[model samples]
Target: MEKEIYSLRSQFEIGLVTDTLVMLLDRGARVPLIADMPQVIPMLRGLLEGGLRHRHVYCRDTDGVYTEVVVFKERYDLELIESASQIRHFNRVLAKDSTL
Candidate 1:
């Protein structure tokens, strides 16, 4: 068994922030546990920006409260493990319209 990893990208659209998480097919049914997922809303953008792997990304929820379950990383200890987070964080956080 191995630790499964999930990554995502997000961006702001109009006035609301949209996010998307990508789970590789290779992970199979071993997806990481996401207890009470409905409450975590920062997504990859704020998560990676606020330190996705180094420390728990804390952000104010819809009610203006903070939580430590923003983004958690798993099985990411390959190389430059400390830097993998930033490497994944890129400029394209929001999905673009193909017609545009």
Candidate 2:
């Protein structure tokens, strides 16, 4: 299992392109694994919901599926980060547009 994202808040938005799952654990939030390749979706499914809300991002590929997960919380349990999903840099922009 790999850790992709941690410490995501309610207002957090992200653009994910890989198989990922974020779990809000008693300790905090954690992504069990973000496959180095998107082909490993099935391997990460079971671990995705270990008593936590797992937000999975996926797109249908030509042959199969690709996914990435995001867990919502205050902190992450993982000690080291090997990879990361693209953080949504447009939260503030979207917020501004919503006011109009």
Candidate 3:
């Protein structure tokens, strides 16, 4: 059987980050596993002064004080891959959007 790859894009508080993972189906159930989390926050920030706004974008401290991680979700898996690309097609898309 052929395997399907699903890209996962997360809306982190620090910034936007993307990762590629594989989706496995077992007994008609779908499961996903991440392969990488390429740090695209800096690159994304350059495009927009603020950051990506998403409902899931949040911060969670692990070790307490100075350690945290942001989370984001998307409807389609392909969108994640597209957002991960370094091409930067939508440069300054939020340049004027004060809300960010």
Candidate that would win on lDDT: 2
TM-score of each: 0.23, 0.19, 0.18
What is candidate 1's local distance difference test score? 0.29
Itemize residue pairs with steric clashes in candidate 2.
Answer: 2-33, 18-67, 19-67, 20-68, 20-69, 21-69, 22-71
**Candidate 1 vs 3: which has more TM-score:** 1
Q: What is the lDDT of residue 16 in candidate 2?
A: 27
Model 3, position 19, has a per-residue lDDT of 35
Give me the runs in candidate 2 sitting further than 4 Å from their true place.
Answer: 1-38, 50-54, 58-100
Ranking by lDDT: 2, 1, 3
Q: Per-residue CA lDDT of candidate 1, range 51-81, in tens?
A: 2334433222222222234343432211111
lDDT of 3: 0.27
Candidates 2 and 3: which is better by lDDT? 2
lDDT of 3 by residue, 41-61 (tens): 333335343444442221222
TM-score, candidate number 2: 0.19
lDDT of each: 0.29, 0.30, 0.27
Top candidate by TM-score: 1
